[model samples]
Target: MVSDKMFTYISRRLSSIKQTPLPFGGLNIITIGDFFQLRPVKGKTAGGLMSTLMISVSTRVMLIRNICTSDGLVNGAMGLGVSLSSIQNGIPIKPIEHTFMFLGHQIVRSQFPLMPSWACTVHKVQGLSLDKAALDLGSTVFEKGMSYVALSRLRSLQGLTIIRLDPYKFECSDEVLEEYSRLRDTLSPHDDV
Candidate 1:
């Protein structure tokens, strides 16, 4: 949620400068997206604490053992951690154990469970419509229409959620912009009516 972080930064900056506040103190916001996907080559990762919080609050089940029964805690089931422990012998190696309740059973495992949700590259999701989507438009958007392609994955405005949407992310090469302007000029208002 780079956009969420940026929005927060802008809000704080404005408040500090103004000395007065706006409605909700300019904190009204909702962010949706997987945080562990591709990050900007030159930008720092955003929302690290928020991502941890989400993992601590998730509801699906994750199974650590490949042979575990698929009743509910499948290989990629998402769930919350019920308990945690650490085993150490003063050898500088300590493995943390996580216990989770899946389908009324407490499953304990030493290895970290794989997260069920994942962030994918835009190319992987192209041509597919998703009920809900979270997009990270960090400092770098390499190709023209990359942002548009990511956004178009959602079937409707209600299904679209954007993260880290800098104004520069919308900029394209001059040739692409010229073509866009031409297409816009060719559209007639009556065509839709």
Candidate 2:
């Protein structure tokens, strides 16, 4: 759910692009999201991203610099000890010498509290298809509806993987189950349109 304010930012950015060609030599724009999650930040909707807006060249440089490699021993080493020190010290490491270095910007993982990264919860990921996904089922008692939605996002069994599934003891009233059934039956795959 895109908010009016986010739409405004996008609209302005698009108009700017129309006036002048983007500096980056490419016309690629990418959008990553699970609409069922939280609606665009209270007025900022999620949708198309601008490939080239008016952001400073330095910002683009920073983005390129942050693409850490994660391949074999060298990449995995960064996740560990002493080697991490030499790495941070400006060792001349080649980009993505290991597969771990491949930062998949296209992935939109699930969001959770106390976690270091941003993610889209199951509720928001419904009706979507991913090339690959890592589902975080979270606590058992909370958000059963969301849990179902998250698992169903992938089109094929090959693309889905559960990160964790702790046992949950939940108490559901008959009414809650009925409502869930009703909503589940009423919503078709295309209802999101």
Task: Find the candidate with the highest TM-score and give its number.
Answer: 1
Give candidate 2's error at residue 37 in angstroms.
9.2
lDDT of each: 0.49, 0.39
- Candidate 2, residues 35-80, lDDT tens digits: the string is 2242222321112122232322112111112233453222112221
Cα shift from native, residue 142, model 1 (Å): 2.5
What lDDT does candidate 2 reach at residue 140?
A: 39
Cα misplacement distance, residue 104 of candidate 2 (Å): 42
Tell me the spans in candidate 2 whose CA falls farther than 4 Å from its real position.
1-118, 169-176, 179-193
Taking all chains together, each candidate's TM-score versus the true structure is: 0.33, 0.30
Per-candidate count of clashing residue pairs (backbone under 3 Å): 8, 15
Give the clash count for model 1.
Answer: 8
Model 1 per-residue lDDT at 4: 31
